[model samples]
Target: MTSLMALVVGVLYAAAIYMMLRRSIVKLVIGLVLLSNAANLLIFTAAGLRRDAPPLVPDDAQVPAGLVADPLAQALILTAIVIGFGVLAFAVVLIRRAYEVVEADDMHQMRDTDT
Candidate 1:
């Protein structure tokens, strides 16, 4: 499972980079989304995939009695997801406005309008 996740992360990273390098603004946004997902997955994978009990302590005990899934990674991923969504939304809006004003989705074409 870890190996599979690692492979997936690697593929996502590669695809994201490829898309980000394209001249199209839409592809760049897609790449940014992919990159954010890849980062989240990387954090999740690094935290391990053990399907143990939840990280909760018994009412009578001060700590959990057995191994438990790490909550830090989950929390971090959740936070990242929210942040990624916001960032993606902003990027899309910005791109849409730029496209409307510049009449071009390609960066090179848009740059030519600076005159």
Candidate 2:
């Protein structure tokens, strides 16, 4: 499972990089979103995975009887997801406003105005 997740993260990163290099503003924003997802997956894989185990302790027990999933990774991923969404939203809005003013979504065309 870890290996599979690692592969997925690698693929996501590759796709993100490919998209990021494009000249389109929409592709850049998509790449940013994919980058965040890849980061989250990497964090999750690094934290490890467990099966049939819950991160909980029973009553009258000092600690969990068996292996319990780590909660820190879950919490971190949750926080990251929320932050990523906000960033993506802002980026989209900024791109929209820029498109309105510049009348172009292509970075090359937008840069032509500098002359």
Evaluate model 2: give its lDDT: 0.92
Give the poorly placed runs of model 1, Cα more than 4 Å off: 112-115
The prediction achieving the highest lDDT against the true structure is 1
Question: What residue pairs are clashing in model 1?
Answer: none
lDDT of each: 0.95, 0.92
lDDT of 1 at 114: 78
lDDT of 2 by residue, 17-92 (tens): 9999999999999999999999999999999877848878889898988888998999999999999999899999
lDDT string, candidate 1, 31-101, tens digits: 99999999999999998999799999999999999899999999999999999999999999999999998
Question: So what's the TM-score on candidate 2?
Answer: 0.92
**Residue 81 in model 1: shift from native, Å?**
1.0
